[model samples]
Target: MTIQSSYPYYLANRAVDANRDLEVIDKHTGEVATRVALADDAVVDRAIAAAVEATPAMARLPAHRRRDVLNGCADRFVERFDELAEILLVEGGKVIKDARGEVQRLIDTFRIAAEEATRIGGEVLPMDIAERSEGVLGFWKRVPIGPVSFITPFNFPYNLVAHKIAPAIAAGCPFILKPAEKTPIGALVLGEILAEFDLPEGAFSILPVPREDAARFTEDERLKLMSFTGSDKVGWMLKGKAGKKPVVMELGGNAACLVDADADLDDAVERLVFGGFYQAGQSCISVQRVLVHDAIYDALTERLVEQVGALRGGDPRDPETFVGPLISEDDAKRVVQWIEEAEAAGARRLVGGERDGAVVRPALLDRVPDDCKLFSEEVFGPAMILERFDDFDAALDRINRSRYGLQAGLFIRDIGKIRRAWDRLEVGGVIINDVPSFRVDHMPYGGVKDSGLGREGIKFAIEDMTEIRLLAIREA
Candidate 1:
């Protein structure tokens, strides 16, 4: 079942194969769908050096040419959109529809990067403050920070990686990418498409290296910046070892959604269900916690139970399958363990809590204890904890109790309460009437506290990969 290309990876615009390979497992059946060649430490060094060697050409490439390359990449992605979606289903375990959405996002990300390529500029500043400086002028525009190193997570193998790759291209920065071992196919295919472009040789590399063997990508001082999108534990550890180079971290979060007394009950339940279970709840901003005001708690709970109970769970290839298997059976069991422990601690399991193979049916629990693993940590599973609160202040305090503060959702129609949420929430972005999972490609998206550092949208990423360089001239 070699559904993807056979090339091990793309390095310096050439396909390279390695002696060792890692099994790419299909989460549904726990079967090896394909094998991806693993990069050795020497391969890692060569990839980085290739990117470094290409830096000068990439940096000097005109913005128009960069824009054309990015647009060309987007065109190539559209041509193989269905193929990439199927690869995402096989290697990433995403349902068909969700997989297609990821593919579309990949296209959109690159298109946005193409649009931004020509817009990279800085404002002119007046330098004639004194008589001696009357004929002087000063201005600054953004320039490529040089080569970039990116390590993307597996959950969103296509779109998340695009957030890193497309921006680097727009800014004319050579980048070395290390995709997650479990889901490296989409990235490798992306690298293949890029290789067909007129990009300078050694512009980029996409290799799958085990986390333990990835120090060359992280600790190397030659790379100007490193953009990491993954769990907090690993992301932070890599940041510490990344030397003095600027680092961007897109770490995990345990996001929450609040339903107030005056909110639209019907709308709130529908959106929350989607948010809590979408992508099997693997998103960093998934709705892990739901705080409902006591006034509408019972009604919302009934609706939520009905909604979550009806979601279909099964194979990733199934179009109707609303929930698919976790990345592995161990991950599914972890979700199950958390739900069972919460139930033992006196939490009421209002709905599903059974697991078959790697698929854990959507589990909805109310009155879960504050100390439960599901409550304190990022579950990354199809489970959501609901709690009832009387006062809004107390609810805000509860929301802020956790270390992670990526994003939070509030459904408040009242002006005062809406203003309060906007003013007081500690998260990066607040959703007015929707769940925290709501993210558009253009908006600046990131978090505070333990969730991570820096924003990841296309334009924002261009900002991270480029810095201002000022040039001043004086008439003699």
Candidate 2:
């Protein structure tokens, strides 16, 4: 299950041992775990050109063939489940349990894509609605959107990459992917799996390169669409440069979870603890804010703090570890600084604000000012802020005040309030009786506003990766 000391990047479905210039660090130990081939601007250009050349062949690929390819990948992922989870732990600093969960998600995403591949159908239109089209028949079907590009982030590297790659394959769109440099092994390993398939020569390329050198991934006119998953800042910047191409962004969010007076305190506390600190809170939709009703705020906070404080923090290799390291020391320092700033600004740290290297103990705080970065911005770390709300509508309004509107969670016993939250909340989705962090692989998952654009489930992503072509027939 150990990773290779060096791995090659894929260029046009071929392994290229160009250079092991990029050293991927084991996030838990802060040591170099593996080195991966890095693609330069020329390699990127070549990959794009290859994708452009292979577009026609990819589009001509049969749906059955595409399904087979995806199903094959899913089966392979199952065989190497432990290996993939191990890589996630070493490269991404994800806890063993979370790593395995992501691996399972990876399998599920590809399987979903397999099911959708053959079902990419269109509907027949009734052209007889108009008198002029009385004898005419019309229909439209979706086709691949030509060459596409992807840039995935470090968090959830495997499944997020699966989100893009699986759909593109199912849609028969040739694509080029730039996985996060810090955790490229997972993507590179996926590239290895994909190379075994009989896809078009240049249908896909996985390049592990520096962000600066990846300008072509966004700027190149050859790519018909760009799908990016990362910080909002970088996602938007890439969109501006993407020129004329469609862009699908899954940027991070400072998601909020509301606990109502009638909610089950025990259930809410357990889910909230998992939502706020799972994978060290590196997920985009990780619960960053908890708004509890005044009636039970004190009780919920007590239970939440106790659970968060008890979470085990250590090497991700240990099955007992719940909270692992951040991506890097700098990231850990950044989270610590934000926590300190909030504490200095009158926020009370309930428990867990210590750091050792890249690992920061999960922290819980309350009475945080609305203006503090810890409260206002996306804290992609193991820290969450607790606040009291006296009114349900006021709590809904408070969640809407943020620029990000990815997803919100509500723990309520009343159906009316749940429906009201669904109707009133500006977020893309509202999780009833569950944390916002809950996401199934097939559900429409994306955000609004600063949280970014478009959705990323298999069918939704397939929609973005395709275009509609109309067919009209007239009987004489």
Candidate 3:
């Protein structure tokens, strides 16, 4: 059954239904699956004001209650897991298998946030240095950073939204969420589930607005911080406009995977197939680049081409579909143009570069020059580039040529080699014997340089949402 309905945005605890509705289209069919409330400038301001008004209440709420609220939301999410997955399929055009996994991630994140709520603590300080300071008693505790604003992207809407909302709830901070207008149903339904919990009034809001119309979200002083997950250009612009308020961004990346000659070829091939093309390659940390040793380059490239070719790219509603259409036809066109440009720049197509509507068949290119956009910029589409390297130092250096340093994959059994990569790679996280796209949701996930600004694991985000308050008492 096709899931179709109208969803409302939250202005604090009050459900706001606007007359102007944004149509949520199915990327594959280009059909309207549902509609969501579109927030005008006035509504966006009200949401921010509501968040500011609720900050004190969130601070005063008991830790236990906060834990319960998060747990309740997780429980509700688990109960409606399939429903949410269906929405993700229609709204984000995610393949069903990936959608299911995203749904489970949502549940895991909320549950993790629930556990983190009880762990919010501060360390005791002992002051006994000098005679004058010997009697001073000093300590610090974590306090909520008031209201937070999150602007999430179209990819992985459920889990990314959870990354922001769960931490705010865990840290007892009021939040305003601005989900991608094209894929807002997952977040809107999440708001509905959160509404079932015993949360304070004016604690949260989920507004869907045009990208050009969301400047207030960044410029408003009422919001203490803005957590953005999207393209590099947009995210940096948001940071520029978000003056005074702290801003955390999870921007774009051409995350790469390296295969050493001593590595397991079969294992590398399997992981690369999934990592390089999952979700149509729209992830910030997707395996966009594969750097293989010269000795095993031919063998690994042959296997990868065969494996990637075997993938079925079709309707996301089908459970067997491994790849689906992009977010829109324009995105698919953009990807095709990039691939063509790379080819003209001397890159050779190894397998799959066909396009049909919004579906660009999984593209694998070889000999892609470092100057090509496919190699230097974030593809954020279904395309993978393979290059061979002789020296380990040169290969690693090439990885750093791009501005992005989000994550990298290294396939090696040598402990020394692994340690070298951990020390040398400029990325935030490195996966050994696997792919760069591998993430467990609990690990510190962010990038260096242009990749992102801060960490985003459950506990880490909770720390970002709260600030330390020091209390010093001197002997009378």
Largest TM-score belongs to which candidate? 2
- Superposition TM-score, candidate 2 onto the true structure: 0.99
Considering summed lDDT, which 10 consecutive residues are worst modelled in model 3? 12-21
> What tens-digit string does per-residue lDDT give for candidate 1 at 236-264?
99999999999999898999999999999
lDDT of 2 by residue, 134-244 (tens): 999899999999999999999988999999999999999999999998999999999999999999899999999887799999999999999999999988988998999
- 2 against 3, candidate with superior lDDT: 2
Q: What is the C-alpha local distance difference test score of candidate 3?
A: 0.90
| Candidate 1 runs further than 4 Å off | 129-135
lDDT of 3 by residue, 229-274 (tens): 9988888888988999988989979998999999989999999999
| TM-score for each model | 0.97, 0.99, 0.98
Error of 2 at 435 (Å): 0.5
